[model samples]
Target: MRGVRGATTVEANCREDIFRRTTELVQAMAAENCIASEDIGAVIFSSTPDLDAAFPAAAAREMGWAEVPLFGTQEIASADGVARCIRVLILWNTDKGQGEIRHIYLHGAAVLRKDIAGN
Candidate 1:
């Protein structure tokens, strides 16, 4: 077995509208990476504290991922950190090697890490 990591971010117009968009972002990343809900070991998520519509993990649960391990936190505010945004680091199990793994930083988050986005 091997480990892989996937990441991504989504922007929300306001704190109240984050859940739907964030859910789309997470599900997109999982689908793009061909990750099975059961294959995901854990998912660590963060939202710019401004976002309070719901914990991004709540969206994951809405997607029918009850058995998956998940956690959520607030992203520290920085001059450069995107506002009203949600991000996640997915620790997954796969047979793929480190080089074969895909890390997804989508939506506005794409600009956050260009090096891996090309992959």
Candidate 2:
């Protein structure tokens, strides 16, 4: 098993923005890891307190992940935490080693995982 991490930031707390950014983040993670919907055991998403317009999992469903186990949560409130951020942790059934997994961080969320963000 391997876990893929990804995160992205939105400009505002709107449904369209949330869906767009979350979709982009999830798609990037899948592409980078070469993951398929069937290989994904579960996906957990977290969003900063400021973002409450939509659940990130909704975007996954729109992307055709209807049967994949998905969950959503709120990030701990912090004064300096990234705003309008959505983070995802995908549990995948794969033989790949942890070091081989790719972690995606896009937009302003890249700063949250600078060491592994690759950009």
Using TM-score as the measure, which candidate wins?
Answer: 2
* CA deviation > 4 Å runs, candidate 2: none
All models: lDDT? Answer: 0.72, 0.94
86: Cα error in model 1, Å: 0.8
What TM-score fits each model? 0.82, 0.97
lDDT of 2 by residue, 1-118 (tens): 8889899999999999999999999999999889999999999999999998999999999999999999999999999899899999999999999889999999999899889886
Query: What would the per-residue lDDT of candidate 1 be over residues 1-119, giving only the tens digit for each residue?
Result: 44443344545545335666767767767776788988888888887867776787887888898998899998898998866667777888887777776667666667777887645
What is residue 1's positional error in candidate 2, in angstroms? 1.1
- Clashing pairs counted in every model: 0, 0
Worst 10 residues of 2 by lDDT: 110-119
